[model samples]
Target: MENISFNMVFTLSGLKESKVNRYIYFVFVLIVYLLIILFNVTVIVTIILERALHEPMYIFLCNLCFNGLYGTAGFYPKFLSDLVYGIHLISYNGCLLQIFVIYSYGVCEYSTLMIMAYDRFVAICKPLEYHMKMASKTIGRLILFSWSFAFLTVFGGIVLTSRLRLCGSHIDKSYCDNWSVVKLSCLPTTVNNVYGFFVILSAVVQGLFVVYSYMRLINACRKSKENKKKFMQTCVPHLLSLINFTLAILFDTMFSRYESRDFPQSLRNFLQLEFLIIPPLLNPIMYGLKLAKIRKVVFRHHRQIEDSLHTKKR
Candidate 1:
């Protein structure tokens, strides 16, 4: 076989079985995609419009919602298009771009959660220093660091991937991923593997940081009833979101690195798509329902809209 061409296209084998159920699957994906956009956008807009929610915690929540939208944008539209057209092919450059967006999204989720953990720690564990520690300028720098670090980490993986000479053009999953792409290379991927391990280790450390933050929070809350209530109201939602995201990412990682072709197609697909589906949908719902300030503003705006509609009808 000749070296992989610049214009080469990869056939995504994950969708081959969905041909008969294409429209049904398409409609289902379309509905979920719409919900992702609706819920995430609602949170983002609410955070932006409500000045009371302009604190570091809510700002981070807004970034998380926006990241959900950014990440899903890389997958759903392409998957929807493939479902409608009965073609599951992606260009070489397109696949790399998708890998960058999706993986960066994953990393950004962790980084954002880590910053949020810090924010919560300051708020609950050291209330007196919260404002000084998480001031507006400090929050801006933290946000910048979170997103920039994620982009550069994944960009390094993509750069390593782009240099490989591919031996095949088939990816067995519904979407492009760094591991799946690296597996296609004809030559040994030592550099890619090393860099990939570094990235994974970085994410694991971020997750550990969040866990440690919460552990201290739990212990601190044990000492004071008011602190316990604050932990329940604010930190619990972050913990839930962290757990949800961690599980989804774990499933995807396990499946990608140790995937078995013998597994049922449906099960395999679910494992691959879980992170993309569950976290984006769950994060906003969890935050909207659990965070008192967001819930109050969401409902207030909702009631105002309903009242306006009722008056119009009258």
Candidate 2:
């Protein structure tokens, strides 16, 4: 009989094995995560409750909320534990799951933003047919396909990634991640690395196409200064989303090596913000502020909910 040894990869290195800083960072992330989750949840709930918000944009907003949920699902629990208890130990299985969740949600988010971009593009670029083009059935199918594509793309990476054998368990981030886990593999990581790179490139390219399409549509519709301002307003969420995703890619790529002892944990923490902090907070605020219709409907919905609850209590 032959014996096989399984080694722990992606273990913490240079980490003080102390609970102090890890717990502090964890608390910070926990507060941020809760805030983000609460905000996104409120947006989703408001949109669902208000018939006035039952439109293509709000539908896409719901999808974005779920994307945030899924993203936080991957990182929050571990992050919280690391914050309060300083427990960074994760089973190899757990690490893989984290990788899958983080990337899958990220891909889904990018796709959802693209769908929203198209919605805006149609609204501005082809206003006459916007309703017909963004019909409920059509929007439903688009959301379905966006999630499916995200699943398929991240699934490829997951399959490739599963092939690596962990030689040690020293991962070099405040959270579990794909590149950090993969960096610990003793086996040949060539295939997984290439697959990951492909995923990153795809996200970047698709995200830009979304941004460009929306901008072009906006420019085409800008016959009057007022119309131009409105068009730009409509594009704000998409622009912020695109920028966040782009910076994420750049930071992830730059720090992919994980061998750079020079890389500050603060920088790593900031990179984490792109995924955890920005989209959830910014999406709802941008939509509510810039899209007058959404703001009005959301406010109306909130009041209605309050009234209904008050009546029930009475």
Candidate 3:
């Protein structure tokens, strides 16, 4: 008999096999995160070790590196552990902490990206006052605000989830998602669910709007000839991040709905690709590969530093 309860996970219409697919996902995700970790670390280290990359762009890139690091911290370890150990044994406190960290880090990453978009807008569009607008002081404050806001948003979710009395535990996902965890509460979860919906709307929806507006502004000022390349370079990473967030939220919401369980295991497994892995995997590539300036800085600085070291040896 299906283990059922009032606090049961109300999935959309699909019931993924969870075992075989989970391991397959683990291998793929592990590789992806490893690459991302390597890339982000390289970028961070290159920026720090090289004087040539001490500009505004690289500074923000460093922030992004840290943000991506925390985002990975939020999700990956738990996910890999679940694959090696088992998902059926996540402690209640562990689940809550996962939700807290994942949401916090995710929010901070997105918010940091918004700050970066603004930084780019100022640099590319308003080169005249770029320094005045994005001075070191200003950048520091912006980061502080971003981190504080991220904590508040994520902590609010934690407080809300903490109030609920959990009576069932059958999460199909690799990690504990806020909505998934709340769906298992024995007590009335109406408040937590409503709060969660608002959190998604506020963070995801608002973040998307900000990104969209910035891109529009970027295109408005860009010349027709250069627009295509600039647009692609600027938008690709944001678009990938947006798509990942959208899919994760969508499938997660679907996973919370009652009809989801009957949908079929294979179909649900396909959706897991976007939710569990794609966001982290695409982040470093999208951010690193798309920006010509960053690549230039990285390569130039690497060569210069090597030459300086050689000269010192002599």
Candidate 4:
């Protein structure tokens, strides 16, 4: 028995959604949000300031952090307000915007990683042409393409969604998603389904491209110790980031498609919140700590700041 929603406001019922001791949730979310901002901005600023880190790999890593920031921006603010007020209601337009920003961020993650892998592949397998292949102009084009591709792809879905007349306004997740919204539509979503399949096809294609690139990289790495070291230093982080994001999105995909009330609310909450929480918080940290040049520059800055604080204390 589906509840018929008369108007545009959608109710989100994911997570504990507790009014009791909600200040605890507020504080927790606030701390995590602040940490995300702090760590991501640290990596981004480090890349900007360090001349030694001006390579295409670092540039794409910076873009990954930017995507993380973009994605979290859609979630943390609204979520904090919800925690504070204990309200889970969102306007139809706000929900759409959330879906766009958050899903675009997800898509951007895949695209950013794809480009990053390409950068690594060229650098490792064709060192002589790396400069020619990944020049500043080329880099700019790729970044633009990554972001533009994501925005346009997600926007296409949003456009299709806006025309639908919803039969139910209740979403069983903490945030709005395109599928959740589409499920509410009383009209047949045949076109939407086709477009959705297209989106999946596109993603699958990207995944295959990444896998092929990595296979080539692995073959090149086996040829020399230096290549292996470089791969371990740079490529490993990207792989981990990819695996992290893949799992998070996988959880979300499963949750969206197979939602059931019999499952515990906590599990459902995790499915909804995993992508929003872990990747945004960890991606920068992973890149920051694992990549040698970034780690060096970061630690140098930390030491310098610590010394300056000690001098002030004196």
TM-score of every prediction relative to native: 0.97, 0.86, 0.77, 0.95
- Candidate 4 ranges with C-alpha deviation above 4 Å: 1-7
- Residues 1-314, model 1: lDDT tens digits: 45554679998975665566988899999999999999999999999999999999999999999999999999999999999998889999999999999999999998999999999998999999999999999999999998999999988888899988988888888999888888988889999989988988988888788888888999999999999999998888888888888888988988889987788888889889988998899899998999889999999999999999999999
Q: Which ten residues in a row have the lowest lDDT in candidate 2?
A: 1-10
- For model 2, what is the alpha-carbon lDDT of residue 83? 54
Which regions in candidate 1 have their CA more than 4 angstroms from the true location?
1-3, 18-20
Residue 19 error, candidate 3, Å: 8.9
Better of 2 and 4 by TM-score: 4
Query: Which run of 10 residues does model 4 get worst, by summed lDDT?
Result: 1-10
lDDT of 1 at 260: 79
Model 3 lDDT per residue over 1-314, tens place: 33233233322222233677767867876887788788888878877877876777677768777777777776777667656554345666676777777778767767776777776666666658988998889988988987898898889888887777666666666566777777767778887768767877777666776667676666765665455566567665765666676667577567656436676666665565354456655665676677776677767767988999999999
Itemize residue pairs with steric clashes in candidate 1. Answer: none
TM-score of 1: 0.97
- lDDT ranking, high to low: 1, 4, 2, 3
User: Which model scores highest in lDDT?
Assistant: 1
Q: In lDDT terms, how accurate is model 4?
A: 0.89
lDDT of 2 by residue, 93-178 (tens): 67777877887887888888888888887877788998999998999899998889888987787676667666666666656667
